[model samples]
Target: MLAVLLVTSCTSSSASGEQGDDAKPRSTSSARPAPPRKPVALTIAPGDRAAGVEPGAPVTIAAVDGKVTQVLVVNEAGQPVAGVLSPDATTWQTTEPLGFGKTYTATATGRGTDGKDATVTSVFSTAAPRVKADLSMNPLDGQVVGVGQPLAFYFDAPVANKAAAQQAIQVHSEPAAEGAFYWYSDKEVHWRPKEYWAAGTRITINASIYGRDFGNGVYGNDSRTAVVTVGDAVVANADGATHQMTVTVNGAVVRTIPISMGKPGHETPVGTYVVMSEHTDYTMDSSTYGVPADAANGYRTTVAVASRMSNSGIFYHSAPWSVGDQGHRNVSHGCINMTTENARWLQSISNKGDVIVVQNSGGPVLESWDGLGDWQVPWDQWAAGGKK
Candidate 1:
C-alpha cells in the first residue's frame, strides 16, 4: 500500500512540472494606463461682432496631445449645430452656416491614448443690421474747394425721406456761409452756398444716413466728411442777340466766341448754368426729348460738339451746318450754335463748375429742365419724397 501511494505522488509531481515548463514568459505583470489626455484649443477669427457676415462661416478646433472626439457650435438656446471630428481624433470643425445678428458658443472635446479626456469652449457674436443713419462725404473730410466749385454728397440708396435725410445734414465753414442742399435724385445730393465758397475758408459737411431706411429696403451706410479750399470765381456770359459768349476767369474776360442762338420753335433757354459737361461730336435729335418726328412737328437728327447747357436737351454744341448763320442769325433749335473748331476751343477751356448765362431768348429757363437737371432740388424737399 505504501509503494502504490508513492507512485501516485510522483505522477502528480511530474504533471505539475510539465505544466510549468509549457507556460509563456511574462515581461509585464499588469496592463499599462492609457496616455495622458491632450489639451483642446478653440480659435475664432474676425473678432468683430457688429460687421455683417453671412451664414456658414468656417470654424476649427484642435487638441495638442490627444485625439479630438467632437466639436460643435450652439446658439443661445444650446442646440447642436453642424460640426466635425478629425480621423486622428485630434481636431473638430463646423462647416455649416451660422445665424446672423445672433450670439453663438462653441465647444470642443478630445481624448488621449492614456484614457484621459479634455474639453474647451468659446463665445462670439455675429453682425446684425441696426437702425441709424450714416453719411459718407466725398472729396475727403476737411478738404478745400477751388473757386466756383460746389460741395457734393452721394447716397448709396434712393431716399424716400429726403426731408429727414437732408435735415440731418449740416455744413460748417470758417466764414459760416449760408448753404443749401439740393437733391438731384434719390441717390445724389449736392450742397452749395448761396454763391461760390469763400476763398481760403475751410468747409465741412455732417451727414448721418446709416440705418435709416430709404425708399424700398435700402439703408444709409455711415456718416462722412469733406473739406476743400475755394479759389477765384469764374463766369461766362452768352447773349443770343449779340451772338457772343464770353468766358471770364476770376471776373476777367479770357475767351470770346461768336455764337448763334436757337431757332424760333426750338429756342435755347435763358438761365445761369455751370459748365456741366463737354464733348466733341455729340448727337442731337428731337426724339430724345420725347418729341415725335412727323411732317410738321418732327425733325431730323443733327450732330455737334455738344456742351451740355442744361439737364434739358440744350447744349452749346457744334453745328457746322449753322456756321453761315453764327453771328447774324438764330438758326439752331436751342443750342448755342458754334463752329467745330470754336466748340473744341471752348471744350479745352471749360470745366465742370464754370457758369454759363444765356440771355434774351424766347424759351425755357434753367429751372424748366431743372427736373432733368435734377441737381437743383433742395435737400428738405428731397427728403419729403421718400417712401417713409
Candidate 2:
C-alpha cells in the first residue's frame, strides 16, 4: 500500500509541472544570447601589390559595417604621406602624390558597433614608365595675342595614346569661348575657337599630365600652365581686282590704303593669312623663297616697315619703288607693296595673330600649316580629334 501511494504522488507532481529529483532545472540561462557583432572590415585599393598604379590616383582605405578611427600611409623610406580624411570618419585618402615605381604601406583602424577594435595593413606600388615626356605650349603667360591666335602645345615625345594625352589638358576662357583641339603632328597640337576670339577674351590652359600614361610605356613627367589674353581684332582685306586694301579694328573700318599686289605671273595666295611678325626696318630677300638673288624675279632690298605673312616668304612691306603703280596696277614679285606711310600704319596696329584676307588674287589657296593658318580647316574636321 505504501509503494502504491509513492507512484501516485509522482504522477500527481508530473501533472502539476513541478520539478522532481533527476529532472533538469528550468533555469533562465538555457540559451545564451548571440555573441556581439564583429568589428568593421578594412579595404585598400590597387588590389595587387605591384608597380602599375598611377602616382596621382587616390590611395584610399575604407571601412564597412562600422566607423574608421585612423589611417596612415608611409613610403619605403618611412616618410608619412599627406592624406585627407572623410567627414564621416569612414575613409581616408593620400593627397600628396607618390613617386613612380615606389613601395608604400597603408594601415587603417576601425571600431565595431559593440566597441570591438580591428586593424588592417596593405602594401602597394606605383607605375614607372620607361620615358617621362614633358610638355611645352605657346601663347605664353601674360602675352596679349590677336583674336585669331591658337593655343598651341608641343610634346617632348610622340604620344602614342593621343586621346589620353589630349584629355589631360584643360582649357578655360573667361566669357566662354567654344573651341576644339587639332593635331598637326604626333607631338604638336593646337586649340582654336569655332570663330575668332572676341576682343579681350582671357584664356587659361592647364596640362595636368604628371604621372599620366601616354601609351607605349611612356608617362608624363610634369605639369604646365599658360595664360593668354586676346587683344583687339585687326583684320585687313586686300582685293587684287580693285587694287585696294581696307583695314578694320573691332568691327569698324579704321583706314583705307592704296596697294600694289603680286604681278600676273606671281599673284599672291588667294586665302586667309595671319601676320606672324612685324619689324620696323627689315630686309626683303627673294632668295629666301627659292628664287636666285640675281634672277629676273629676285631682288634684295630693305624696307622701312614689313609684316611677315607666311613661312614661304610672303610679306606686305613698304615699297617706295612701287608707289607710282600702287593704286592702279599690280607689278610686284609676290608681295603686297604699299606706300611707306600705309605699311607703318599696318605694323603699328597689328598683333601676331591678326588676319589678312586676300580676294581674287589668282593664286592657290593658302595651305594649312603655313604660318598660323589654322583657320583653313573646317570645324567638323577639326573636331574629329585627329590621330586619336
Candidate 3:
C-alpha cells in the first residue's frame, strides 16, 4: 500500500513538469533583415574627363562605400586605349600613344559583392596634351601654286614637337635647295631654301602622319602634300646715297627710279627686306611710328604705293615734297621717296616676298623689329629652340 502511494506521487510530478502540447513555446517566423542597400555616388576629377592621359599623368576617382572596383577609358570614337591600367589598380594609365585635341571618357563601376553594402558607378576624364607635332604637306599626290611661293603650311594648332614636326615635313623640288623651316612660334612656321628658290621650279611638301600621335588623343589624320611652281625671283636694290632704286626680275633690271632717302642722321636701313604689303596713297604720320608731328620732330604726308618693307614707318612711296632731291640727293627721314609715276612702277614690279635691299644708310635696318614679333629673330637662333 505505501509503494503504490509513492508511485502515484512520482507520476503526478512528471505530468506537471512536462509542458502541455498547447503550451509549447510558439515558434513565430521573423523576416531576416534585408542586406544593406548600396548607396549611389560617382565622382571624378580633371573636369575635362576623358581617356588618353599624358605619360605619368595623375588620375583620381571618388565613390561612396569604396565601390569603385573598376575604371575604363575610351577614345573619342569610343575605342579603348591599350594598357590603360596600373598594377595597383588605383589609377588608369595608357602605355600606347594618345592623340592630341582628342576626346575620351573614363568609367568606374563598384559592386557590393561583400553583401554588406550597395553598388556605385562613377565616370571621369583625363586628356593628354599635344607635345610633339608634325606638319606635313597635304595633297600627297601633289598640286601646284605660284612660282614665287614656297610650300606654305599653316598649322591648325600650336606645335610643341618642333623636331618631329620638322622631320615629318619634307620638301621635294625638281632641284632641291636644301630647305629648312624657321619656326616663328608655336603658331607660325616658315620654310625657305638656303637661298631663294629657283624660279620656275616645282616644289612639293609631304606631311605623313597616320599612326603618329600628337598627344591629347589628337592623332594626325590623313597625310597631305602641297605643291607649288616657283616663279622668277624678284630682287630690287634701293641705294640711299645715290637716291635711286633699281628693280630686277629674273636677273634683269626692269625699272629704275630716282628717289630721296633719309637725311644724314635718320637714314633708312641697308639690308634685304621683303615686300610684305602694297597700297596706294598711304598716310605718313610721324606720330603713328612714335615720331612727333611738330615741324621740328614730325613728318606728315600722304604718299602713294605704300609698300611696307619692315614693321617700322619706312616705305617706298610718292614723295612730292622731295621732288627736287629725287634721283639726285638723299634728304628726308628714313624712307625711299619717289615720284607718283615711279611709285606706281614699283607696284607693278614688286611682289610679296620680293627682295628690297637698302644700301649705304646711316640709320637702323627696317627689319620687322617694332611689331614683327618672333620673325625678327635670326633664322639660326629661331630654330635652336626646337626639341629633337
Candidate 4:
C-alpha cells in the first residue's frame, strides 16, 4: 500500500507539472502589424537636381490619386514665379518664362483621399546664353509726345526670328487704337496706329523678351516697359507751289507764314513727315548731308529755331537771306526757309512727332524707312509686315 501511494503521488505531480507548462503564456513580441501606406504621389518637371534646362521650358507639378493643396516656385533671389493651378487642384504650371542661368526651387503639398498629406521638393537650373540682345526704345518713358509719334525698338543685334521677336512686345492704349508693328530692317521695328494717335491717349508698351531665344546663340537680355502720354495734334501744311506754310493746332489755323522751299533741282520731298527733333540753334553744314562746301549750291551756316523734318537733313529753319523769295518762289536748298519769328513760334508750339505735310513738290515721295516716316506706309502693308 505504501508503494502504490508513492507511485500515485509521482503520477499526480507529473500531471500537475504538465498542466503548469501548458498554462504558461507565450511571447508575441516578434509579430507585428504593418504600417499604413502614403496615399499621394507627387511629380515635378525639371526634376530634382536637374541642370541645363531651357529658359522657356515648361515647369509643372502634378499629384496622382490625390489633390494638390499648395505649390511654390522661387528663384535664388526669392521672387515668386507666377503660375496658375487647375481648378481641381491636381496640377500647377508657370505662366511666364524663366530667366537664363537661374536656379529655381519648387515645393508642393498634396492631400490624399485617406486624409494623409504628402510634400515634395525639387531644384533645377536654366542654361546660360552664349550671346544676348539688348533693346533701345524711342519716345522714352513718361514723355508727352504729339499724335504722329510711333513706338520704336532698336535691337542691338539682328533678329532672325522676326515673328518670335514681334510676339515678345505688347502694346495697350487707352481710348483704344488699332495698330501694327512694321520691321524697317532686321535690327529695327516700329509700331503705329492706322491714323495718328488720338489726343489724350495713354500708351503702354511691355517688352517681355527676357530669355527669348533668337537663333545663332543669341537670347534676350532683359525685359522693359514704357509709358507715354499723347498731347495735342499739331499739323503743318506746306505748299511748294504757293510757297506758304499753314500751321494748325487741332484743325484750327494758328499761323500762316510765308516760306521759301527747295529750288528746281533740290526740291523738297512730298508726302507726310514727322518732326524728329528740335534745336534752339543748329549748324547747317552742306558736308553733313554729303554736299561739299565748295559746291555751287552748298552753304554752311548756324541758324536759330531749327526743327529736323527728315533723316535726309531737311529742316524748317530761320533763313533771313531768303526773305525776298518767301511766299513767291522756291529758293535755297531742300529746306523750308522762313522768318526768324515764324520759325521760333513754330518750334515753341510743336513737340516731337508733330505732323508735317508737303504737297505739290517736284521731288520724290518720302520713303517709308526714312526717319520715322512710318505713316508713308499704307495700313494694309504695315499690318502685313507683322508676325504673319
lDDT of every model, 2 decimals: 0.62, 0.84, 0.60, 0.86
TM-score per prediction, in order, is 0.53, 0.79, 0.55, 0.79
Q: Looking at model 3, how many pairs of residues clash?
A: 28
Candidate 3 scores a C-alpha RMSD against the true structure in Å of 23.0
Residue 71, model 3: Cα distance from true site in angstroms: 27
| True-structure lDDT of candidate 2 | 0.84
Candidate 1, overall lDDT?
0.62
lDDT of 3 at 137: 37
Worst 10 residues of 2 by lDDT: 1-10
What value does the lDDT take at residue 301 in candidate 3? Answer: 76
- Tens digits of per-residue lDDT for model 3 on 16-58? 6874445533344445555555553545543453444332233
Per-residue lDDT over 1-388 for candidate 2, one digit per residue giving the tens place of the 0 to 100 score: 1122211222224767766675543433224455556668778875546567888677888878778898888899999999888998888888877899899988888887767788888888889889899988877888888888888788888888888777888899987999999999888888899999999998988888888888887888888888888889999999988899999999999998999988888988888888888888798988898998889878889999999888888899999999999978999887899999999888888888888998887878888788778888889998886655
Clashes of 2: 0
Using lDDT, give the best candidate's number. 4
TM-score of the candidate numbered 1? 0.53
Where does candidate 4 clash, by residue pair?
A: none
**Model 2 error, position 279 (Å):** 3.0
Q: Write the residue-wise lDDT of candidate 1 on 1-388 in tens digits.
A: 1121211121122555554534544333444564444444434342324244333345567666566776667888888777666676656666665664667777666666555667666677654544333444544654433444566566655667677667656778888886666655666776666656555667766664544345344445554655555545556788888888887777788778888988898777777766556676555766766776654665765555676756556777777787888888787767688888888776665555556777887767668225233234444653343233
